[model samples]
Target: MIYIVIPVFNRKEYTKECLESLRAQTNQGFSVVIVDDGSTDGTEAMLRDEFPEVVVLKGDGGLFWTAGVNMGIRYALEQGAELIMTMNNDVVVDSDMIAQMYRWHREKPQALLGALELDASNKKPIFGGERLNWKLNTIEHLLHVLPDAERKGLHPVTHLPGRGLLIPRVVFDRIGLLDQKRFPHYIADYDYTHTARRAGFELFVNYDAKILTYPEESGERQIRSSKTFKNYYKHLFDIKGGGNLRDFTRFTLKNCPPPYVPYHLANGYARRLFGYFLK
Candidate 1:
């Protein structure tokens, strides 16, 4: 069985739209698991009223993205789900996207899969595969340069985002759930996928399977207009800030070779410092 696990904290309308899109999918073989992490916006009540068929898991609001998703994943495994898809609630997927992803999964049985995310306004890609650029200590996104035709084929990626990502049960059994304690919010998905890749899993983005993304409604995003020296230090370690320096440092130290960690950290700091002044 395939179970789609969604972690939501408020934004009832977005979640409602996401579930509606899933319900309209061409593939009727998948079930949904919603981990509502203390949504005060009547999201849980709405689910009970409208989409009760979806297995709903409640949280006390403390469980952030990583743990919230982990909770639903554990439930899916317990219910004999062979495949688990982790996705955010801010996307509207194409009707055939799920079926397309399943078909690709059948073809690449050992690979971790992600979907091409496009902006809702212009239908242009919002984000794609993220590859760590060690020299600049920043992530390079493929959508910025990928040709439209090339996107119609399979593209290998170093790090796949969590949105519309398909993960087989064996991966969880092998590497365990995402590191919630270390990454409560932002950096968890990249860290989890990196761990999976280290465990011999090939990560990829099947650009043919696409979804419309509401980027403005998504998770913590850094504001370039407010990138000042003091403001940078203020939210440097704050989990709500997208540019959490501590999390970046932790990710670097955990993934980079011991000898390169220092250099990467220094480079990352310099770039952020420059952004403050340049912008």
Candidate 2:
């Protein structure tokens, strides 16, 4: 059976919509495990009353995205699920998404799978799997390079985003769970895919399977809007914030080769500083 893991906070409306979409999926051989991170907005109570079939794990509001997902992943593995799917609660997936992803996984059992993410407003591609450039020490999204027709089938990727990633049981047994302590939020997805690649697992994106999600805002507006030093520092260091220097540095140092680590660190800070002034 396939187990779907979702990490949620205070967004009851989004969670409800996401669960509703899941319930409408074409494939019914799946169970949902939701890790509710201490939401005070009646999210837990609502899920219990409305969606009783879901397994809800409570948190102390400290388990961020990575920790919450790790908890759900562990629970799914214990339940003997053949495949585990991790997704953001704000995303509403296509009805055939699970079926398509499962079909692809059956064909390539050793491959990590991901689906295309489209903007909920404009129906444009927002996030998808990417190819890593070892020579340039950068990554490029597949959608940017390939046309819609060419991207329809399965294609290789260096890293897959966390939004709608599917992992087989064997991958977990070999590589292990995401690093919740070091990469508690941002860059954890990249770190996981990098680890899987190093351990001889291929990453693929099934463009046929799509999910609708909101677009992330640019950091220029955020930094420009910060009126106080406290707010500026908060945005600068926030894990969800687009430009969290500390987390980016940690991810670079841990994943990049020793020779590229210093270059990446310096480049990351330099870009942020340049963007701050230009904004």
Candidate 3:
């Protein structure tokens, strides 16, 4: 069976919409496991009352994203799930998503599958996957590279974002759970997918399956959104902040070769410094 794992903190409305979309999927062969991490906003009660069929796992609010997702993934694996699909609560998937993903997985069972992300409002592609530009010392999302007409089928990628990603059971048996200790929040998905790619798994973005996402709610909010020291500090160190130096450093050190690590780090900080002033 294919099991869908979702980790949520609060935002009951978004979770409800996500669950509703999942329920309406064309393929009803999958089960859902939601790791509700200490949502004080009546999320647990609402789940019990509304989505009684879904397996609910409670957390102490500290599980964060990586640990919370890992908790559900463990349970899914224990239950003999053939595939595990990871997604965020802020996304409303298309009705044919599961069917599309299943077809893609069947065609390329050895691959790590990713679904295209579309902006909820604009319906334009978003962060589907990442490609490392070794020359520029930067990581760029494929959404910016491929146009709609060109996204015909699967394309090679280094990291697939967890928001609507299909991971085969063998990945868990090989790479183990996501690195919650090193990346409790942002960058964990990229790290895990990149590690999987390194471990002989091909990464691909299945253009057929897609999710409508709320981009504004992304943990990827840049520090340049504001010009304050606290924002800068969070941008560099906060667990929820994307491209934080600590987690990004861990990811690069673990993936990038030694000689390229210093260049990547230096270029990253330089861009942040320039971005802060220019913003």
Report the number of the highest-lDDT candidate: 3
Q: Could you give candidate 1's per-residue lDDT for residues 143-181 as a string of tens digits? A: 877876777756778777788999998899899999998
Worst 10 residues of 2 by lDDT: 215-224
Across 80-131, the per-residue lDDT of candidate 2 in tens digits comes to: 8879988989899899998898788888987889898888889888776778
* Residue pairs clashing, model 2: none
Tell me the tens digit of each residue's lDDT in model 3 across 1-279. 789999999999999999999989999989999999989998999899999999999988799989999999999989998799898999899999999988988899978898888899999877667788755676777777877688857888878788888999999999999999998988889889989987999999998898999877765454556668888777667776664777777877887877787888788767655565564
| Candidate 3 residue 54 C-alpha distance from true site, Å | 0.6
Clashing pairs in 3: none
Candidate 3 runs further than 4 Å off: 222-224, 277-279
Top TM-score model? 3
Lowest summed lDDT across 10 adjacent residues in model 1 is found at 218-227
- Would you give me the overall lDDT of model 2? 0.84
- Scored against the true structure, residue 73 in model 2 reaches a CA lDDT of 97
Ranking by TM-score: 3, 2, 1
